[model samples]
Target: MYRYDEFDRDFVSARVAQFRDQVERRLSGDISEDAFKPLRLMNGVYLQLHAYMLRVAIPYGTLSSKQMRMLAHIARKYDRGYGHFTTRQNIQYNWPKLGDIPDILEDLAGVEMHAIQTSGNCIRNVTADHFAGAAADEVADPRPYAEILRQWSSLHPEFSFLPRKFKIAVTAAENDRAAIQVHDIGLQLKKNDEGQIGFAVWIGGGQGRTPMIAKKIKDFLPEADLLSYVTAIMRVYNLHGRRDNKYKARIKILVHETGTEELAAQIEAEWAHLRDGELRLPDADVARITDYFAAPDLPARAEGWAELAAWKKADSGFASWVTQNVRPHRHPDYGMVTISLKPIGGIPGDASDAQMDAVADLAEQYSADEIRVTHEQNLVLPHVALADLEPLYRALQAEGLATANSGLVTDIIACPGLDYCALANARSIPVAQEISERFGDQARQEEIGDLKIKISGCINACGHHHVGHIGILGVEKKGAELYQITLGGSADENTSIGEIVGRGFEPEKVTDAIETIVSTYLSGRSGTDEAFIDYYRRVGAAPFKEALYGDKAEAA
Candidate 1:
């Protein structure tokens, strides 16, 4: 929760005024659609298939209860009654009128949020581990560095309008919850042998038509040299990255074409000139930013441990929810509660305005008045005391937010496919809904174990299907929708791109195909202890392919 200063407020207010003028011009016919296209995009507005879509940035996925309330207000007052939480931890409103967007932007600016850099080829919102400040195993909170990057890159003259969109992710936890490997630039904060903090820099990782894991360009970049090093990488890419084709414009493509060694050398050469210059972060500034993210004070709640055990014994439903949605926190007396937006058979990440309001109330009452949006399309109360669990669960249940399917098959991640996105080939929501309903049973989900099923309407990988344990990609073929399946992909520390199992299945057959894959995994796994990903890695995609396509698997 970095509070905006006077300068920050003035900056955002000025941008809002500028966009308001632009929007007015477009509406007044002073500017044609062609002329206003780039202007609208820069302000985070997209002309979708049916209506305009507005993407609001939730930087590093942190939100105050007040901010959450503002989001809920926007949803209730402006567009449809709900908002879609995206894989990037942002939110999208699908049915906003073009004229009302500036008013919406003004509302967002009032809460220190905006739509800037949420789209376009500039560095998008700098994301970090949703569990950054609360994770038990974090070396340091990554949000401060993320905020620093945000401040530096916002409207940066040099890096703006790059060959393609750029994304950067940072994580301090060893578990890699941020999916840093699949970002244009990934930073893993770690302590050196001498106990000095730094980052393990990875560049060129991305997913689209060409999915590639980022390569480690620097083993250790001093925390102070973060900006300098990152700028060097950007300079290299900006100079050489392809501009002719949007298909091959990402830095990942440049990394593939230019050898990693040569690229590293170029970055180093650039860094030598800038490392000790004005870009170097001073310890005082770093400390000031870090202070903004200091952990909340947690009074001892030791009695909750006993109370929680008794509550679990009394209610199986509550017990199941605790087992699924809760994660260990840095404080033993507290837990990180993931409020699953993906209810069984419900749209994966769509939250109604009332639900958002309810979550805000619960966060203020039970948690520390803070909410986190996960890349998995879930909301998190990161500092809920164990004692507050029962009431929080009950409140969330009433709001229909307590699904108890955090990492299960029912906790699906999908994009706004053909239903909303003009670039989409087929509908993603229907497929996600069908799969969720198929495995809606709690017992069945438990049997399936931890599984991630990501679906994208097209090859853009908006749903991160490339890294899903069971990925579903929708493609158009011969005037029909075909769903392609990829198995064994993961977005964790040991990141790997999934392999296509076989020929694409018809929309009607996709659910059945997914069921077959799950059944095959259950039967082939050595024991329940072996997760789907582990088993798939152990045996490769051959078994799933065979099960899906039968004897024709080889040809596929």
Candidate 2:
């Protein structure tokens, strides 16, 4: 993880004090609600349904043990005893009092963390692949570039106060675990024929009332030209992006209204101005940031196949957890262990304070003192020794974090819907909970294979429901909570937005509809090896629709 320099430290300290003053003024009635809205939003504080919610940025979703412990401390002291990890790989405190926000921000700054840019229409948190440095197929670590962007966009006077929120994501892996295709600006780190590094830039990708996959603007931008290129894109959006309507204010809308070619041309024209200016990233600076993310000093050891095999034979439960929750690492002797927040019938991505502390302890002892938050709403011990699997599982089980359903049907992603957010139309957590309980059995989940079910209360797409294999969006229709289902959506390398199957189902009938869809897939699939996504792509949504709405409705 990149440690904060003197400038970074001083920057956060000043911002905290400023926000503290702002909060005090609002509480003292010196500023009205409308007057304090932007001020509080700039600092990542939101007035939710029942209380104020604070979103703390976990930049690139990387955390040290100390930072994790501080989050646990905040969860224990300020709000409730738990925090909700979000699809953006950030954490949210849902019950923080308005007066306590400044203190919470101060505590976060103490651990080199903050809530800045986590909200508002400005550039939000810069995210990256969860297994960035440790992934077996990574071309290079993307965090250095992400950190560079973070520094550049932090409070850039030019780009702040855009028409709507901006999100940027980077990934070096071919798998696209970071969902680059669905971001405002998506950069894929790649090496060209000459083995020089750069990025394949994509723009206009987003999901809301209108969903879109980003269009490729640049095939290969040079390494030194990254900052200038991104600046060009931003300049184009800031100048021409929609400002009259909040609904169409996103850069994605601008790209949609004006074609990609024209957008790219405008961006290029803008880049011609700033290409070699002060915005050009220097080689020495890039190298300095890159050095901060060098791989830890890990010793080489033979694969622990014999011991792991023996343990698996002895304990079936451990074996199940290992099979589902473990990912291959760059180093053969090590593995990336995913601590699933989706226990059977539990809320997705909700980690208690005690669980956070326990994960920090486990990371320090078993992993290399590093933790990662995934876009799928799970935590990762990015570099755990294969030999430590049994003990790690035991510790995680003790903390109520040992769910063996990392990518299965039960591993759901849900947003804080009507339960917390005032913008929500219906409840999302209970829907997720019901579906989770429906497929809670390990054997049934294993039978379902790698299926992602995402739920959002409304069309803001905070839950990333647009990209799930089975996307559920809860809507209010005729004074009832109805769930709309979309099939074949995925956020992987071959990203696609799901298609709506039919009429929305009532809340009580949602679980049965999901089961019907799953049953249809199981019956139509070529084999178990064919994942839900691949099968859906092959067979189309016909059978699933028929299963859900019957033959005449499917034909219609």
Candidate 3:
């Protein structure tokens, strides 16, 4: 929702021109693939298994209705008629031509969006709670701080080529919807007893071969010190982080080797010099950014379709949808609606051009022209009037976008694995598709109760499989696709890494393996209301392992 100032616009335009020249150089043979690799990556272009993929950063997952429409246009005109929304709350065009990326970047800059930090080992896009401005219980909106971070990190000279990719997530909700615990740096907005706002800082959290929750570096950071404190933390990590192996280069590894106490001490020492310096945010600067996210005013009473209330009472289907899709807003008369990208039999995060346009139109017409992309791979209309629910629901349903399965079993989060990513050992989309199809029935999915299924291509954990309630990681054994399942993982305030159940199952056996795991939970659980996590925490993975591999088999 933030518009680009003159400095911002010029910065992006210059970067685009720079990339255009680099591209021309590469095509003219002045630069080979090896030479152009880093340059292209810096611009968020990747040479995937098939074609070049362009990742456009949606800063802190905020987009205006105009920006949303521009993305839809890009999907239709430039590449395929669809785009993939990622777990990072960014959008990916799977088939962008190598030569057309500059044009794409130009179009993106026109809408005040850029792809600068969407890739590479440098600091990536800073993610925040998707429900930031709209959440009723938020301490303060996190986008202003996130925007400050974006400006400071963009093309930063010293940290540009860091040891590994860095991620930061900020959340103010009582429940950590942003999964802040699993980020390189996590900021939770908190208010002390004195009623002054500040941050609770956590550092060194990430998922991969080594999954670790972030440890708290500081319990309370003054609001004015947010940017400077973040600088100190990044500086410490940038200096001490390991670079010996790509797999172990993250700040988490440094936290492990140096011990959290020592790491915190180093950050504190660095902060003593930087705090209250030029980087410290002033109230005027904070107010200028906050003005962009001002809450939309709504009618005192939105005129309802009496038909909708009747439908809610009479039809359980509609009721279930309202229960899952609708989220509370800070405004009394307004609410936020999550439009599920994962409909039955559809890919988890892929959205057709028409669907995007329809959602964009709805955001402009029914909502206040505000849209948000959640890390769960869903689109949110943040200011829909409570009274207009029926018409919005109908419009979404007609476009096949109204699947009320948020946070349910079929609501899967997955990465574009072997299908798109060259680093993937096995295909993740098909596995996600199969699981979604297997639990396609609405009644069955609801009866299964609250469950999360995430699939990652490899140990890098791009799909966030490590934090899923029923996490599935795709691997390759003898060039054959196999899946390894993990249970008891979650990504919220109570974050924990899942434990592996047993040996890997062949591709054909994976869906069945998941079914067995779910079935075992249903039978052993106290009731259908108990979530898969509750069952896992109650009885542990022993019984589930037996169900997947059967009684006489050994649990891996």
In order of appearance, the predictions have TM-scores of: 0.99, 0.99, 0.98
Note the Cα lDDT for every prediction shown.
0.94, 0.93, 0.90
Q: Judged by TM-score relative to the true structure, which candidate is superior, 1 or 2?
A: 1
Clashing pairs in 2: none
RMSD of each: 0.7, 1.0, 1.3
Candidate 2 on 450-531: residue-level lDDT in tens? 9999999999988889999999999999888999999999998999999998899899999999999999889888999999
Off by over 4 Å in 3: 302-308, 552-555
Residue-pair clashes per candidate, as listed?
0, 0, 0
Residue 108, candidate 1: Cα error in Å is: 0.8
In terms of lDDT, the best-performing candidate is: 1
Where does model 1 exceed 4 Å of error?
none
Clashes of 1: 0
Which 10-residue span in candidate 1 carries the lowest summed lDDT? Answer: 541-550
Estimate, for each residue in 105-218, the C-alpha lDDT of model 1 and write its tens digit. 999999999999899899999999999899999999999999999999999999988999999999998899999999999999999999999999999999999999999988
The pairs that clash in candidate 3 are: none
Tell me the spans in candidate 2 whose CA falls farther than 4 Å from its real position: none
The worst-scoring run of ten residues by lDDT in candidate 2 lies at 547-556
The digit string of per-residue lDDT tens for model 3 on 63-105 reads: 8888898899999988899999999999999998888889999
